[model samples]
Target: MSQFGKSSAKRSKPSYLYAIIGVSLILFLFGIVGWLFLNLKKSGEMFRENIQVHAYIQRSATKKQIDSLQKYIEAIPYVKNLEYITKEKATAKWNAENDTTWKKFLDNSPLPESMDFYVKSDYMNKDSIASLQSELEANFGGRVMSEFQYPTETVGYVSSYTKYIAAGILLFAIILSIIVIISIDNTIRLAMYSNRFLIKTMQMVGATRSFIARPLNVRAVINGLIASGIAILAVFCFILLVEKFVPWLKLLRDGRNMAIIITGIIIAGVTISYASTHRSVLKYLKMKLDDLY
Candidate 1:
């Protein structure tokens, strides 16, 4: 074949530059979604841990009885942290937030003296809190709490929506994974299209399958790394922007889990790119000479 024919064949092939850019964009989206999932889960956990049970202390309880009640609650194994809320303190906090002065209208502050405490992370649920409330009310009775209550509606809300959120995320991720695989495969194949003639030429000249595939595999690996790097850098920048704008989101980050997610992204990029390129090369090597067109 003339040199012009070879050059023309190469030019007919799709641009690897565009292929890389396409793959990188898709991978970047995956990284963002994965990171968001991690943060959402962490945020959910934080919300759970922040959930507190408020046990109202009896107005007529003596100082000795209050001390005993505090000691009793502290002894509870699943308690993460406990706080004492005086009626005066509660009134002040309420006034600060709601612009209401309880002191002037009421002879005694209507707010009850209370024990406010958080349950352990694993126990932050409607059932466990209910059990704890029942136990506290039964154990302390008139000595500590006149009434035991918590944000049951909030716990119920968390329970009601969490599974749905998880399912939606899972479905989105599944669809995203399918998209990544198909798009990357097509991108790599289009890229390999430009090299089909070269592959056939090498095979006709008696190059072994391994020898034909080796350089293409290496190139694929390199391209994959470059694409993964670009995607990761983009996602990292996005995360920084999120943390900057909503600084509290940083509290949900887990270093170890983030590292695992990043590692998975790189591995996925390399695996899919190299496999697709190799498959396309093998395919060209086995095709009839006339199919080179």
Candidate 2:
């Protein structure tokens, strides 16, 4: 009986090896897609945060009012990189960008003092900015203009493009995940095929279902871990190789996101492997000796 079991296991050895390799490749591809999604999200956030919103101060406003407005805007949760741009500074900035200085055209600078700031990525949208503008105007009265200005077209374009890209990636990831699960299940079932006769022989000799399944289940867990480990190593190496060429991708490294991806891959591998193996074992045990042949 032991000799028979050993012979069955040997027959399944090649299939087991192929299953591990197949699962590892699938997992590696999934990990790569996850990493790409994370990097895209981070990059979008950085781009959105760079958009500068200029809240021009009323020229007739007093120093106290200007300072109060600056403090108030700075205190807002969505605000970042807040700066109180005085009239002189604003004029200098304008001149630096334009070919001619304002002094060449006029005696006094026509530029207004402003509260230049950026909003957090979460609030970097048309509706959010409009709401923020309303809130600021209601709170500050006439200290700062209600008509805050920024690149509205740029914001709209960024937001629309980001949503489309994110949706596309999400859809692709979902499809790929389903494919990976099915592929892993099929691979595991094929590996279990060679042991069908062995399972029948053991069952005929009074082996309980649990007794026949426990060892195979344990082997399944080990193989799952091995596949997960290989996939993780491959992902790490691929990232390192890519970053070496496109160094800017290294800037988007997010430890928390990467950790989540790793944990997900590990769980997927082990859970799918164990479930598929045990399911296949039970399936074979239910079949008659003739069916096994």
Candidate 3:
């Protein structure tokens, strides 16, 4: 019986290797998709934050009044990257961008001093900005904030398509997840096929199902860990290679999202391997001796 079991194990070893490689490839694909989604989300947020809104301060307002208004706007929850653009700073910015000083063309600079801030991505939509504009203009009886302005058309375009892109990626991820599960299940079942006779022989000899399954199940878990580890390493190398060429992509590296994807891949691997292996073992155990042929 020990010799038979040893021979069966040898026959199954090659199949187990192939199964791990196949599952690792599939998991690597899943991790790539997850990384792309996270990058898209981060890029979109940075772009939205770049579209800043300027709250024009009244020229006649006292410094105390401007400071009070700046403090008030800073307290708003949706605000990010707040800056107070003094007339001198604003003039200098325009000059640097246009490559000419305003003083050469006019005695007094025409650029307006304003409070500029970016809205958080979640509140960057047209309606949300409009609501926020209303709230800011209404503050201090509408006298402090002369006008609040952002690119309405740009906001409309960005916010509208963001939803569709997110929906499309999420749908793809869900479908790919189903495919991964099915593929891993099939691969594990195929690997288990080589051990069917050993399992049945053990069963016929009065070995309990659990006792016969214990070693195989343990082997399946170890194989799962190995597969996931290889997949994660492959993914990390791929990311490094890509980021080496496109250095800006490094800015979007989100550790939390990557961790979640890694955890998910590991869980999927272990769960599917164990379930499929156990299912296959039970299936062979229930078959008639003649069916072993």
The number of the candidate with the highest lDDT is 3
How displaced is residue 255 in candidate 2, in Å? 1.1
Question: lDDT by residue for model 3 over 115-214, one digit each (tens)?
Answer: 9999888888988998888887777535677888899999999989988998998898899889988999999988998889999989989999999889
Best by TM-score: 3
The lDDT of each candidate is 0.84, 0.88, 0.89
Error of 3 at 74 (Å): 1.0
lDDT of 2 at 95: 79
Clashes (candidate 3): 0
Error of 2 at 143 (Å): 3.2
Give the per-residue lDDT digits (tens) of candidate 2, residues 1-293: 88888988789889889989998998998889888888888898988999999888787888888888888898898899999888789877887898564477788888888889999998898888888888888977575564578898998888778778878988987998898899999989988888888888888999999999999999999999999999999999999999999999988888998898899899989999999999999999888778776
Worst 10 residues of 2 by lDDT: 139-148
Once model 1 is optimally superposed onto the true structure by TM-score, how far is the C-alpha of residue 164 displaced, in angstroms? 1.1
- TM-score each candidate: 0.80, 0.92, 0.95
Badly placed stretches (over 4 Å) of model 3 are 99-105
Arrange candidates, best TM-score first: 3, 2, 1
